[model samples]
Target: MDQNSAKEGKGLSIIAYITIIGVLIAFFMNQEKKNSFTFFHIRQSLGLWLMYFIFGYVISGFDSWMLTYSFWIFFAVLFLYGLLGAISGKANSIPILGDFFQKLFKSLGN
Candidate 1:
């Protein structure tokens, strides 16, 4: 995408990483323009949030602080990574599951 497109989508893109609600907000807001950059981040954030909830449920069963802390840190780093990319107007995916997310949500911005 062009720089202008990136610039236009930057706000909603960053918002997409804020929370699951942000993802929904960005998604509906971007519906008219169908901004690819915003949609890209939306997919990433959506997947991350879903993973967080799913894993959080399982992690809650564990009593070890180490396990809990690790889970928190892992998701935090991933969220931050995606957030920074959106802030910088880049669409670099989060590591590991990024490609999977793109493929999984391929129909999102279509």
Candidate 2:
């Protein structure tokens, strides 16, 4: 991305990490600026966040404490990866689901 585009998209990019609220803010913010790279990361972050809640709910049902803790730990790792991508201005996917999110939300931007 060029400097101008990066500058324009910086607000949305930063907003893309505050969980679900950030997702909504980024989406609306991107509407005017419309940076593809920033949009890609926003969509990817949204998917990861949505999955995080789903996984949290599923894990909560498990009776085993160890399993619950492990699940949350894994989610934290993924969240960190997504955050790093947003901060670094790269659409780097979180290990297992990065490509999947890119494909899933491809229509939103491209």
Candidate 3:
């Protein structure tokens, strides 16, 4: 998609990834006008945030530099991947977990 068409849903797409509150706001924002691009991002961001919490709890016991950095880098990359896609107006799923997220949140985003 070109920049112009991408611009339409970029705002809500980025907003959905900002925070939990932002996700809810973006959800409602796109309720009236459903933008597939924004919805795709919302699903990805929601999946990322949910995984962040799940991993946080699971990794709390493992105190190691390798684990620490790996965890941070993994999520960071995922976040950046989605954010950049949104900025560029692309509907690319994050990477590994993206497709699953899209499927999981399909009902809501649609």
Candidate 4:
């Protein structure tokens, strides 16, 4: 939680938001150091990617461009929010599902 820790983990934390693969890479990379900042972003990105895939499957059934665009935009904003937080070395969570992600992935960094 200290600035030094955050600074140390900043690169991997940003990488965590790149994609699900990035999440895996970041997770494994952090295993050695066990950076909490990196793990926090990993959990957030993992949850976001999982939700995106699940919702994308459901959204595919709909032919509405509005729904599709909305889905894309929604996830985009959330990703951006998390990415910026990581870049800034802050541990802020995504808006609504952030708390759930932290709780769901509570065992991640342990």
Candidate 5:
């Protein structure tokens, strides 16, 4: 990547790790700039955030006592996967729901 591309990618990358507000800002900023690397990270980060919310909802509904322990483990694994993907520049999906989020947000890239 060129200097401009690298700069743009860096901005996108840092923004992705922030909370939802940062993600939205990054999404719009990248949209205006039209950076490929930025878009890739945005998609991944958005998917991560979406997955977090979905898991929160489902976990809240469960009544099992063991589920509390299992939920933290599962969330930790997913968090690690997301953080690794963002840091390593790999487009690998987060275990189960990653692919679904990609498909769901496909239109956003267009």
Candidate 6:
């Protein structure tokens, strides 16, 4: 990729990992100027956020301390992993969820 593409990819990827709102912002940002690298990160970030809310709710049902702490730590590690990949302009998937997210959110467009 060219310098501009790499720079934009990194920017989009970083913004995508920020928060749910950042994900939406990055989505629109890429609408006009599509970058596969950035799109890859967007899907991964969205999946992480989804896992956060979904698993968080499910984990809340349990009163076990070990489960709670492990749940948070597990997802935290995944988030950090994806964030580092984005910062490096890598299209690396976020462990298991990476491929699923890409396939699931492919309609999100270029």
Off by over 4 Å in 4: none
Q: Write the per-residue lDDT of candidate 1 for residues 15-66, one digit (tens) a residue.
A: 9999899999999999999988899999999999999999999999999999
Task: Please rank every candidate by lDDT, starting with the best.
Answer: 4, 1, 6, 3, 2, 5
- Candidates in order, TM-scores: namely 0.97, 0.86, 0.90, 0.99, 0.72, 0.91
Which lDDT tens digits does candidate 2 get at residues 1-110? 66666566766876787779989988887787679777877877888788988988888888999998888788788878777766766656778898888888888865
RMSD of each: 0.6, 1.8, 1.8, 0.5, 3.0, 1.6
Ranked by TM-score, the better of candidates 1 and 5 is: 1
The deviation in Å at residue 41 for candidate 6 is 0.5
| TM-score of model number 3 | 0.90
Please give, for residues 1-110, the per-residue lDDT of candidate 3 as tens digits.
44554688899999988887888898899998787788888899999999998997888789887987899899999998888888878989888999999889999855
Which residue pairs show backbone clashes in model 4?
A: none
Index of the highest-TM-score prediction? 4
Question: Could you tell which candidate, 3 or 4, scores higher by TM-score?
Answer: 4
Q: Which ten residues in a row have the lowest lDDT in candidate 1?
A: 1-10
Task: Estimate every model's Cα lDDT from 0 to 1.
Answer: 0.94, 0.79, 0.86, 0.97, 0.70, 0.87
Q: In candidate 3, where is summed lDDT lowest over 10 consecutive residues? A: 1-10
Q: What local lDDT score does residue 9 receive in model 4, on the 0 to 100 scale? A: 99
Model 6 regions lying over 4 Å from their true place: 1-4
C-alpha lDDT (0 to 100) for residue 106 of candidate 5: 78
Better of 4 and 6 by lDDT: 4
TM value for model 2? 0.86
**What lDDT is reached at residue 31 by model 6?**
89
Q: What is candidate 5's CA lDDT for residue 104?
A: 79
Residues 1-110, candidate 6: write the lDDT tens digits. 45566677898889998999999999999988888778888889998999899999999999999999999899989999999988876677888888999999997854
Give candidate 3 misplaced runs (Cα > 4 Å). Answer: 1-5
Scored by lDDT, the top model is: 4
lDDT tens per residue, model 4, 42-69: 9999999999999999999999999999
Each model's backbone clash number: 0, 0, 0, 0, 0, 0
